[model samples]
Target chain A: MLKIEEYRQIIDEQIQMLGGMKRPEGLYDPVRYILSLGGKRLRPVLCLASASLFGEYSAALMPALGIEVFHNFTLLHDDIMDQSDVRRNHPTVHKKWDNNTAILSGDAMLIKAYELISKSPVGVLPQVLEVFNKTAIEVCEGQQFDMEFEKTSDVTEEGYLDMIRLKTAVLIGGSMKIGGILGGGSLRDCALLYKFGLDIGMAFQLQDDWLDVFGDQETFGKKIGSDILNNKKTFLLISALNRLEKASKKELLHWINRKEYEAHEKINAVTRLFQEAGVSEVLIQKRDDYFTRSLENLGKINGDHEMKQEIENFVHKLMARSR
Target chain B: MLKIEEYRQIIDEQIQMLGGMKRPEGLYDPVRYILSLGGKRLRPVLCLASASLFGEYSAALMPALGIEVFHNFTLLHDDIMDQSDVRRNHPTVHKKWDNNTAILSGDAMLIKAYELISKSPVGVLPQVLEVFNKTAIEVCEGQQFDMEFEKTSDVTEEGYLDMIRLKTAVLIGGSMKIGGILGGGSLRDCALLYKFGLDIGMAFQLQDDWLDVFGDQETFGKKIGSDILNNKKTFLLISALNRLEKASKKELLHWINRKEYEAHEKINAVTRLFQEAGVSEVLIQKRDDYFTRSLENLGKINGDHEMKQEIENFVHKLMARSR
Candidate 1:
């Protein structure tokens, strides 16, 4: 079995070899540019780690790369939809190029992701595609729901959780399941891996919500509270809304309503209100619940304990991030 | 073998059965809206027609519907990119909904297309996906080149043709090829069908360019010279640039350059200049050459002559649009 670091190295090398970067510079330049930005590479690594637990990690490299590309494709489109100016502390695709270029290139990336996974073991191609397509459509649905939440004030905590599950967790779960499938894991084991990934993915996103308000600026690589400033309906905000008294809720809404207040002032006031209403504690508890559930699910997976422990270590490293 | 009407009916019915219209009204609403505002359903019909030539057309119905969904998906995205306000006398998706909705819904449609085609008969699923993926990527490349052409002044006639081939012809070819694959046709026949569709599709697009400046407004459902007013780099414009004398080119450019000329006056002068340069006859001959070649390719396909004749008739009906 490969170590976690070895799986990561394999994924990175495989990505470099998957060539489509050529002419039509307008189409591919952004693809190559974003792929080169070199984020955590967490998703593909998880895929390889899962594969290594049951079979040769090398056998699953292509599918692992496919998951990574798919992950990036979602980010590329999401950046445009959010009108985000920065990603990885650099200009976003829509910022570096134009929106038209970003949209077209992002579309190409989505199709390329399908092409990447298209070479799955022939016997398993249909199931792989089933997972891939279902996840893809759900991701789109999740994005749609996120956008809808922005326009509505009636969003519940359950609704917010479901949205994130669709938006983030499914891809993670699907990736691990895909890896397990490539590893020739039994259906039961693959299903368990998916549940583990899903719960862990939920924790990962909630941690992100937590980090947005509390993470160190230097480590996070972006200013904290941008989510607050943007009125993002993150778990912190949603939970705060659920728990805050009418007066406290009114104060939170007032701070949220200010369009032109001092950035730090709004963030401080909102964070203070969140702390007073126990929003932070609620988020921490729920996040821990997910984390525990994820571990429990991971424990149930039928694989070598050593390999599973390696998987557990990788998750801890990711979840423990401040950046 | 089926009649043309039967093939079209089958496609339309299959489309209605492929349901996803539900909540997140912002998302599926536009999908239903655009699908409702249907056009010729040409690509999917071609898929069915090709399938009927060798095997059970009914078996290929789902995939045939997939081609239509895929075609509409392209149109939805293209409408946004082109900033087109109208399609088939209806507001474009971006106009009807917002740009974000159009973008997200268009993405859903693309995924939906893959889902539709994913149900290809088990024996042919991989090949179906191969054709679909290649065509999908090439279409994006075509759009990129088309967008690139807008900024390029040195677009050659050859370059323009290649762009249209990628942007437009390949999908037609791919759809027929997919249909041939579904029908269990011999590889040689499938290839011939692709060539047939390529030539015929090329002819179809050229006729569209011709009709844009010259067709009947009532029948065409759009104003003539719209492409001219928008400065579209169509085959006519590219060919005129290729063939016109320097002085004549200057005059045409002068007319083209005028921002606020009387619409009819500019249209008449351009038409007269095109006639003087023999541009009209040049286009007519080239279009016919493609048409003849398409028929020749169609003849080589290993299908009954009657089925081939039906496809030919459909081509003639499309090509016989106003001069």
Candidate 2:
């Protein structure tokens, strides 16, 4: 049984091998530049790992890369939508190039994703396309809801969860399911893996929300509490909104509305407010619950126990990451 | 025995049926609005016509609709990139809504196109997808080259044709091929129809450029010489550049390079220059050549004579249209 790291290594190598293209200097250059940035390659790793549990790893490579490309395509568009200047410790495509370049390149990346995923064996392609299309649309829906929530004053936790499920979890679920079908896993196995991935993805996102507040700068590879500065409606912020009383809520809103507060001061004040409200602890409990459900879902898959254990360990290590 | 009008009617009905969706009003509403502002419906009509030549019209309806959706998706994005405020005699999506709405809605529309195309019969889907994906990527390449050409002065006729082939002709070719495949046409027949469509598409695009210059405003349903106002590198302009004396070339460049010239005056100047250099006649000859080749390709397809003639009539009728 190959370890999760081995699967990741394989994905990394394949991604590198997929690199080094020439021509259409405008179109292909940005694609190569973004893919070269190397953001954990986690989705492709999940794809390859899930496939390896039942069949040869090589069979999953194209679709695995397809998932990664699709993921990055969204990021390219999202950066422009969000006006995000930075991603993965680098200037975003839109920032380095222009908005038109970002938009066109993103469109090309999407078409490229379809071309790559179409390489799936004919038997599995219809299902793969179904999953990919559903997830792709859901991700867009998620982003829409995310943007909507940014303006609304009354965003509930349920709405947030549903948004993240669509935006984040479904792709993860679909990636694993794609691998399962390609690897000839049983329908039941595919379903369970999807559930496992969805739950794990939910936990991973919540961890992202929590980490933005409490994570170490060196470990997180970003400035902590930047979400607070942007007024991003993360789980932590929403939970804190629900937890705080009128005065505290007003104070938090003031920091949010402030146009020119000292960054560190504002971050510290928000962090203390979150601590006092006990939202951080509540988020920890929620994240752990999803994480536990994911593990249980994984345990239910009727595969080799050793391989299952390796996947289980991989999930744990993912949550343990600070960045 | 269905004529092109019958195919057009079916496409119109299908497009109308695709309307009436709710939710994500910001996202889906724009999709519906844009689709409602019908263009030629030529692509879908072609799809159904080709399919009807062998298979039932119903069999091709879904993929035909898919091609239309894909066509509109490109228009949605292109409008944004070109910063064009108008399309089809109505406000473009970006103008009606905004850039972000246009971008996201366009993304969703692209996903919707895939979903619709995925409904291609399982037996024919792999080929349908192959054609669709290749066409999609090529369109992006064409758009990229089109943008690049705007910045460079030395764009040749060959380079422009290749760009438009990728941008315009390939999708037209792919649409016919898709219909042929779904209609149970043989590989060779499908290939020939694709060639036919490509040649016709090339002619269609050249006609578009020609009309943009000399077209009657009411008949064309658009402002004549708008392409000249935008300094578009149409065949007329390119041919004139190749034919003009050095002094004539400098004078033509004077109008093109002028940042603040009267729109009518500039268009008149360019139009007169185009006449003097014989580019207009040259373009007519070029367009006619492509149209003839397209007819020749259609003549070679192994379909019934009457059916071929009806399709041939459709081709002529399309080119004969003022708008």
Candidate 3:
């Protein structure tokens, strides 16, 4: 199996190479600054690992780098839309500069992603571009759905799942699928890998939701019950709302309606209500189901047992992390 | 020469195809609505005409359509950023819907542009993608330069030209160049075609600046001297700032510095100063020079005499238009 460190190094180097030109003074600096505040590099790593499962991982580097650039491009724009103050503990591009700068820098980053991907080996470029185009549109669709949900009242769990699947999971799936295509995998196998990644992504997002409410303060890196405070329609909250008795539903609505409440007290109230309503357990089961489904899909791939085991071990390590 | 109506129909149909079945409810409707409101469709028409100079104009439809979609996408986003209220005598997308929806829909339109370009016939997809990527990035660079100029004091005419070339010219160049490639033109001919289109685009933008200040009210179909009222960095203003006597420069600065002023008075003062400083004539001469240069470049392309004559006639017709 490929070491994560190796993939990280390649991605970092490629990103630097992508940003290695003298732009008009203020133009490209924001791109550099935003890319410098790093995260897990999870998407590109998935691309490389999926490619390695079929052929030389190095073959996937260019496309994987494209995925990383595309992800960061989305982040830059999303930050502006969400009015986020910080990203990776640094001021967001929009916060650091201005909305117009963020918009232009994000636009450039997106174009740069296309440029990098178009540089893929000739044999793979067409199919890779097709998949990339679809994924890009789906990501935009997902974002639209998300924004709609903020103004809507009738959002279902299924709708939210589909939205996240497009917004977050498909890109992760696309990362691996593009890698698989470049690695000479069969179309069927590539589809399976995409599904596997998507399932894991769903589980991963569920875990994030869980942590928002129940995580340990030191390890979670966010305050407990943050979603409740923000009126976020997480799986747990929506499920709880759907399943609660009339009295419990009213209580939840009351808390949700309040613009100001003591943080600790509200957190405790919501936590207790969630516990009584079995929302926490339900979310855990849903997360496990996705994880299990992802593993099952992974098992369908024809590869050496040792290679599969190595990937499974890596997955286990990722799942074990608290933050 | 291909009929402009034939090109317009193809582009309109192709654009409709881009907004497929799964479009988000409110988000994409405004984009489609705005697009349907219609304009001259000049960019796509130029693309087809350039392509036809070498072979069948129909061969260039997909890339031409891609250029049109991409252009409208930029307009959608730009309207949001500029807070403009009208487009083609109708309320702009952001005015009709909200900023967030406009932004998301504009994003979807951009993805749709990529999709349209990616699905171009197999032989030309690589070159199309390459040109599209470069043009897209240059557009962003232009937008960034435009935003940066808002905060900076030393915006020279050269700086403004560079910015407009990126922001407005390169996409037009890409449109023609991609069309030429699809029409089986030689690489050298394609390069010349692109240069021709770029020069024409520069002149077109300059004409726009002139119209903003001096165009006939009935013919312009927009508020006259609107750019002056908004204190935009048009070529005339920048030239006037550079060439004016110290007293006039100081007075101009006073008007520029005052954020609140009577619209009519400010427009009269700026126009008077620009005329006095010979800024208007300078801009007119620059526009004519670009127009002539573009024609010269068009003349240099190695093509059949009849084809060259056809394009030259079309350019004359375009230059003769008042708006």
Best-performing candidate as measured by lDDT: 2
lDDT for position B215 in model 1:
84
lDDT of 1 by residue, B1-323 (tens): 44778878766766776655676777888888888786788888888789878887776778878788878888998888889999989899999888889888988888888888888876788898899899999999999999999887689878998999999999999999998899888999999999989998899998888898878998876799888777789888878877888998898889878888888888787777677777777778888999999999888888867888899888888888665
Q: How much is the lDDT of residue A94 in candidate 2? A: 90
Tens-place lDDT per residue, model 2, B1-323, is 45787777778888888776556688898899889997779899888888867767677888889899989999999999999998888999999988988999999988889889999888888899999998898899989999998888898888888888989999999899998989888899999989999999999999999999988788887789988988898888877888898999999999998999888899899999998898888888989999999898898888767778888988898898783
Which segments of model 2 are wrong by more than 4 Å? A20-22, B20-22
lDDT per residue, candidate 2, A59-175, as tens digits? 788988989999999999999999998888899999999988899999988888888888899888888899888888989998888888898879988889999998999999989
Q: Write the per-residue lDDT of candidate 1 for residues A1-323, one digit (tens) a residue.
A: 44888777777777777655676888998998888888778888888788777887765777778889888988998898888999997899999998889889988888888888887877888888888889988888999999999888788999999999999999989989988998888999999989998999999999999999998888876689999999999988888888889999999989878778988899999999889988888888999999999999899888878989988988887788783
Please give me the DockQ of candidate 2 compared with the native complex.
0.81
* B-chain TM-scores per prediction: 0.96, 0.96, 0.94
The Cα RMSD in angstroms, rounded to one decimal, for candidate 1 relative to the true structure is 1.7
What TM-scores result for chain A when each predicted structure is judged separately against the true chain A? 0.96, 0.96, 0.95
lDDT of 3 by residue, B1-323 (tens): 25655777777776677555455776678767867877777788878877877888877787777788888988887777677898888899888887767777777777777777776677777887888898988887787788778777789999999999999999888888988888888999999989998998899889889889878878777889899888888888888989999999999989899988789999999889988899878888999999999999998998767767876777777666664
Q: TM-score for each prediction? A: 0.97, 0.97, 0.95
Please compute DockQ, using alpha carbons, for every candidate against the native two-chain complex.
0.76, 0.81, 0.70
lDDT of each: 0.86, 0.87, 0.82
